[model samples]
Target: MELITTVIALGGVARCTSLYAAGFSKYRIALAVAAGELVRVRRVWVATPDADPFLVAAARDGVVLTCVTQARRLGLWVLSDPVPHVAAKPHAGGIRVTKAHVHWAAPLLPRHPNALVDPMENVLALVAACVPFEQALAVWESALRRHTVERGALERLPLGGRARRLLTLANPFADSGLESFVLPRLRWLDLPIVPQAWIAGHRVDFLIGQRLVLQIDGGHHVGAQREADIAHDAELMLLGYHVIRVGYRDVVENWPRVQDLIQRAVAQGLHLAR
Candidate 1:
């Protein structure tokens, strides 16, 4: 009945394992002593004299272990030179440790004796940590050509959030200027429907509910097409549809108001439909 939670770094950028040594009565005091030593050392080999059985079990189970005692025992390489290892201090619940380098040994290690070495996880993790998600995914996608990782496979890993966000931002519909801001909010809204007949008939930016269409009027929507836009709106109105035009200014400078407008329009459309 042990409950475990993976500790994410302060900004939700990385995951760490928090060790809890309180419950195992058989090894309570030993566990407490080991925890203390782990906090001080920042990295430890599992075989270290101060290593606790509970902590060792947790690491074996793939729980995010961060203390030095666990790090050293896991075969993480320590630099011989004097560059300091970056350390995150223990807070309210558990001590946080930034791993200097990930060991490809345990689960990520290749199983077949004659198999070529698989550096995918290590490379992906390093790329995920260093670069923005999109660049990392690009690297991953390219690497997939020679390897077996699929588009959806990476989402099951610990770094899935990074991959998911990157892919979502790359959507053609995502606004280049507002891509980062809008993608997170888009998850809260129901996806706009794509009209079956209108896909080729006319390009609508977004169809909210069933009757209201939101058109993002970019710079391209101006000039000779201005009259055409007016004609199009008239035609949509004749077809019992409400067209709401959002200019680039509204989307870029006053997005909250734009969201409010869309929310209200959807509510009105729902009421009319009912």
Candidate 2:
């Protein structure tokens, strides 16, 4: 049970010799292996068959998952990019990364010898260097929203100019990257914009002033969720809330139009409860 707990805690993958140090006898490990409880990556690594393939691959190729790939694995929202990102130690050469985006930047925190997943600190640092400013900010804000990393902790690091600015804008209150992007863009508006505002028995994505409620539908907003949102929008309207529901794309791609609509609403005094 100790061996199983150790492997599960390690995200279902670890070096074959790792179990020995955790007090599992070599004979016990061999017995488990023979019983099909673990699959050996080589002579040195072992993983449960259900372990994440990406993590197992990173382990096999000797790199720590980093940047957007790691961010996505941690459930942070990032711009879609197919290429996997991995990191190696600064001085460690002989890495074959024909299949991944390899980052050779030295980690901010110490990494372990068998690190398949990266520390959140390293993941954000690599993301700051690898992605564009807006996208990186989104991921950073998402991490802050999830409390995966604290803004104060990241602020204390020797971050570059762009990263420092992003940290300043990151609000742990924002629910998603879409919310993060929308909040900063609308900062030029001199009205109170509250996120996750409860009104008409639903928590809106944002409530501008007292009546204007904004909702950004993410990619996964479909079927049952779509029906539920529609129902809530009607309820909000009955309660005199101005609902502005838009797709996540509108916030990212067609922002000027959204901005214009919002401006008009504010001009018409629709944001205020009269």
Candidate 3:
């Protein structure tokens, strides 16, 4: 019972060496395995029945789950959840490479011999290299918002190229990944865009200039939420603000039309305080 409890405490999965280091005798480990208290993973690791499948697979393949894969696991927003993105040591050999994006760069921090997940620093670096610019920035901002990694700590690292550039643009104010997407596309307009700005007792997604409020309805905008947003838009208009409400598809799939709408609004000085 104690052995099973210890395994569960060790994140439901642990290397055999870690277990031994914790003072479990080899005979006790064998007995636990034989009694079905633990399941052996590829001879070196053992896991409880309810271990995270992703971590289990990482252990089996001798890789650390990193990049967008780890980002999603950390509750940071990712544009998409594709196949697993795992990291292996640059010189690692005989790894199981099947249906997963393998990152072979040296990690920014040393990985523990028994670790199944990459450090947050390494995850951010890999995300910068793996995904497109906007997508990577969204993930980075999400990390900042979640306090998964400190912005100063990330900046202090000896980052280069894309990672450094993305850090420069990454801010913690985005309410959603969609906000991350919208602000950068409109940055070239040389207008001030404040995200999650408070106005008229509610928060707008993006406030461009002084009076233009952009509201983004993400997946959670439905039924009462939709009605409430409509009410807020009405209130804003009555108070002399222009509201441009957009859906996920509008901002994502049909962005050109959305940009045109904003440009027309700005052309008429709608963004200016009336």
Candidate 4:
């Protein structure tokens, strides 16, 4: 029971070396394994029955979960990926991963031998390198908003040019990934696109220029939330704000249409205060 508690404290999985160093003898561990109190992963790892399957897979496959896989696991905003993303040493051989995107670039931080998940900093670096610019920026800004990684610490790292550019643009104020996606695409308009801007006692997604307001509806915008947002739009319109509302699909699937709408609004001077 004590051994099981120890393993659970170590995140329901632990290396034999860690177990040994924690004062559990190999003989006792073997006895526990025999009695089904612990399950062996590959050779040197042990896990509780309820251990995270991803970590167990990482341990068995000799890889660290990284990139979008790790980003999702860390509760950062990331586009859906059907396959797991894992990282292995550039020269490390005999790795077997099925239908997974395996990142072979050198780690931003040295991975511990017993680590199943990549460090947060390393995960961000891998994300910057692995995903597209907008997607990667969303992840980075999500991390910033969640306080998972600090901007200053990231800025001081030996980041590549692409990553450095992303670091410069990443802000901690996006209420959703959609805002992150919209800002960079429309920055070319050279208008003031303020995110999470308060208007008439409510925060809007993006307040473009002086009067054009863009409200992006996430998955949570349903039923009562939808009604409230609509009411807010009515209120903004009453106050002389031109409101344009969109959803996940509007931003992700049909961005050009959305952009055209914004551009036309700008061309008509709708964004100008009357």
Candidate 5:
């Protein structure tokens, strides 16, 4: 039962040998497979019948899920999920599935032979290496927000140029990937920026300068949350604070326009509560 639980916990599938470390023998695990209690993913892997399709496919393809795919599976805020990203050692030899986005780089830390899901460290490292800076920063901030790995621990690893730079910029206090994406871009404004800051009885996404509030709303579109956000904007305006509210698309897809708006607000001296 313990081995069965462990496999499911590991994204619903894991190598058979890993259960051995938990006191289950190959014979016992095989017996469970025969008894219809577990599905034999292959000669060496076992899973519940309801394992994730991606993990099953990764297991079959002999690749580890990494980058945005892994981050999304870990419940992080990913900008989009167009392709299933997988990784293999730089020279893992011929792979069955070459159609998917495959990263041929070896992980900073070694991956086990049976790991269907990449470790958080490997996922972040790949994300930093492969994705654009803005997208990568969002994932890094997401990992920090979830406490999957800490900056101190990541610093201990021998990270390369980009990963090392990303580690330095990572802030766990960031509440969302949007906050992660927005704050760094606006640093050129030469003013203080505080994220997840309490203002007007609610936590604004960012408080720039003395009174300029920047908010990035999620993609939920209109509902109770939107109404609440509108009320908060009103409250902030009444309090002599300038509020710049933009949707998720504005931050991700139309950032130039959003930046222009912010720049105009700053030029107007609206950031200061005169």
Candidate 6:
């Protein structure tokens, strides 16, 4: 009983009784009866009259009991019982597919909090964790796109030049940088016209060939600039140059008409040049 108290304190409620009865007292009926009775008092809810008298007596005295029946009902215990045990049969399915788990490093976590996990991260982590890196890149790319916008995750991905270019042109608006969206596609055709090309050597927005000078009029080009522009167009005509002027709205909204005008001016210039 003194040894049992020590075991109970060290081994918690579950292991104490088993250790005492099995190691110290052996399988003797008298010891089992005495221990069992003490165990019932500690766990009255688990005590039963059909149990051994000695065990019953131990229960009445309040010794902690570890019952398999109670544990099974609560799903809290997992100890093997000496009684006969039957194993559950496995389910017969048509086919079973299994996939391996992938782990990623902390730094490689998606930069875009909204972005999904991708194959680039998977392949990187796998390689770091000792997996091969050859054909695994393609496999990872496929898996990554399914989970995330792989092209959008290029800043953090180990992508090459061509892949980066493809990603860049995919959604040009995704990046707000000047290089991506604001920069003009054609240099000489996109600049605005200035007053210097008018009288005191005002510079216009664009000069197309030697004979055609184009002006894109915006709100700022009204009032004084508009008067100057009318005067300048006459002088430019006298100088043997065709001045084709258009508004910002025409350039932005009616681009096709503006392009046609420029093309006609270019053809006229080519003919005059010859």
lDDT per residue for candidate 1 within 13-34, as digits (tens), equals 1112222332323243245336
Put down candidate 3 lDDT per residue, 92-132, tens digits, no spaces.
Answer: 88997799999999989999998899999999999998899
**Model 3 ranges off by over 4 Å:** none
Clash pairs detected, candidate 3: none
For model 4, residues 38-107, the per-residue Cα lDDT tens digits are 9998789999888999988988899989989999998999977689999999989999899899999988
Over 4 Å off, model 6: 1-200, 270-274
Instruction: List lDDT for all candidates, in order.
Output: 0.43, 0.86, 0.91, 0.91, 0.86, 0.39
Report the lDDT of model 6 for residue 71. Answer: 23
Model 2 stretches astray by more than 4 angstroms: 1-9, 23-43, 219-228, 238-240, 272-274
Superposed model 5: Cα runs more than 4 Å off:
1-11, 18-40, 220-222
**Sliding window of 10 residues with minimal summed lDDT for model 6:** 174-183
Q: For each candidate, what TM-score against the reference?
A: 0.38, 0.82, 0.97, 0.97, 0.87, 0.30
Q: In model 4, where do residues sit more than 4 Å from their true spots? A: none
Residues 69-182, candidate 5: write the lDDT tens digits: 999989997888788999977877768685689988868788878778888999999899888998898899889989998888899998989999898998888888888888
| Per-residue error (Å), model 2, residue 18 | 2.0
Better of 1 and 3 by TM-score: 3
Candidate 1: which stretches are off by over 4 Å? 1-160, 168-200, 270-274
Report the lDDT of model 2 for residue 255: 95
